[model samples]
Target: MVQQMVQGSVDKMKAELVAYIDKKFEIAALTSDSSGASNTEETEDSDPITLSMIMLQIAAIFEKFGHYDEIYRTYGIEADAFQDECNEVLDLMRYQVEQVESQLKDFQNRLHIEESGGESAVRHNAEMQEKFEILSKDVQESISQFDQYIDTQLKQFEDMPQLLERLQQELASKQGKSESLVRLQEHKSEMIAKIKAAVEELNLQLPKVVSAQIEKALKD
Candidate 1:
C-alpha cells in the first residue's frame, strides 16, 4: 500500500486529508425531489439559484476526493451518510409544506361559515397571521442555513481544484477510484431528487400563504 503512494509522501498527505475532512465535516448531499422550475424569486432571503442546483452540487464535491472508502473511515462520508443528509433537509421542507397545506385546508373549511368581513373571519385571519409569522421565521432560518451550505459547497469545490486534481491523479494511478467516484455521483443524484418536489410546492405556496400582513391586508 505504501508503494502505491506517490513518491513524495503518504503520512503527510494522510494528515492533510484528515485535517481537511475534519475542517469540512462532510460535503453533505442536500436532497430534494423533482421540482418544476419553482419560482424561488419571491423571497428576498432565498437563494436565486434553483434547489436542484444546490442538491446536485455534491457531484462537484465527490470529484475532490481520491479514496472513497478511506474518506468514509476518516470522515463520515459515504452513500448512506449522504442519503441521511439528503433526508434531513427533506424533513425541513416537508415540515413547511405540511404546515402550508394544513393552513390552506383550514381556510377552505371555514370559507362558507365565516362572513367575509365578519368577526369569525377576522379572528381566523388573525390566527393564520400568527401561525404564518412563526412559520415564516422558521423557514427564513432554514433558508439562511441552506444559503450557508451553498456558500460552503461553492468554496470547497472551487477553492483548490488544482491541488485536488493533483492528489486524485496521483492516487488514481494505483487506486483506480474513478469508478468509485462515478458510483458516488449517481447515488447523490438519486437521493437528492426525492425532496425537490415538496420544496417546489412549499416555494409556490409560501408567498400567498403569508400575503396578509396583520393590518395592511387583513381588512380584506
Candidate 2:
C-alpha cells in the first residue's frame, strides 16, 4: 500500500515537472533580450529567476518522490529515490504482517483448547466435590452405627467379666459344703469362653468395617 502511494506521488510530480518545463521553455522563447535595450536588464535579472524556479521545481520533485537515501548517493541531493525505498520497506512489512497473522491464528487455536480444558476441569471438580460430600455423609452414618454397636457390645462384655468373677468367687467360698461347686465352676468356664468368642467376633468385624470405610473414602 505504501509503495502504491509513493508511486502515485511520483507520477503526479512527473506530470507537474513536465508542465513547469514546458512553461519555462515557452516564456524563454517569447520574452527574450533580442532588442538590446532591455537585453542587459533581462539577462541580469530574468535568467537567474528562471534558473532558481527550475532548481526549486526539481527539488520539489525529489521531495515528492521520497527516495532520500539513493538521491543522496547518486546526485548528492534527494531525488526520486523515495519511491524505491518505500517499495522495499513496504514489501518487508507485508511479509512480517503475514507471519504475525499466522502466529496469531495458532495462538487462537491454543486459546480455544485451553478454554475447553478449563471448562472440563470445572465440571470434573464439581463432580468430585459432590461425590466427596455424599461419601462423607455415608461414612459418618456408618461410623455412628459402628460406634453404637461397639458401645452396646462393650457393656455386655463388661457385665460378663463381672459375672464370671462373682461365680468364681462363689464356687471358691462354698467349695467343701457344696458338691455342686465343681459343676458351677465348669459352667462359669464355659460362659467365659462364650464371652471371649463373642468379643473375637466383634474384633474381626470392626476391622472389616474400618477397612470398608477406608476404601469408601478412597473412592470418593
How many pairs collide in each candidate, listed in order?
7, 3
Superposed model 1: Cα runs more than 4 Å off: 1-113, 164-220
Clash number for candidate 2: 3
lDDT of each: 0.55, 0.74
- Residue runs of model 2 more than 4 Å from their true location after superposition: 1-115, 177-188, 203-220
Q: Quote each prediction's TM-score.
A: 0.24, 0.36
**Model 2: colliding residue pairs:** 66-82, 67-81, 67-82
Candidate 1 per-residue C-alpha lDDT over 4-74 given as tens digits, one digit per residue, 9 for 90 to 100: 34222445555655655443333221112223343332232243344465445444434433454355455
Question: Which digits, one per residue and each the tens of the lDDT, describe model 2 over residues 23-139?
Answer: 667656645736676656655655533778878888888765757434445653333576678889999999999999999999999999989799888999998999888878877
Residue 32 lDDT, candidate 2, scale 0-100: 72
Q: What is the lDDT of residue 84 in candidate 2?
A: 75
Report each candidate's C-alpha RMSD, comma-separated, in the order given.
Answer: 53.9, 13.5
In candidate 1, list every pair of residues with a backbone clash. 32-195, 32-196, 33-193, 33-194, 33-195, 33-196, 33-197
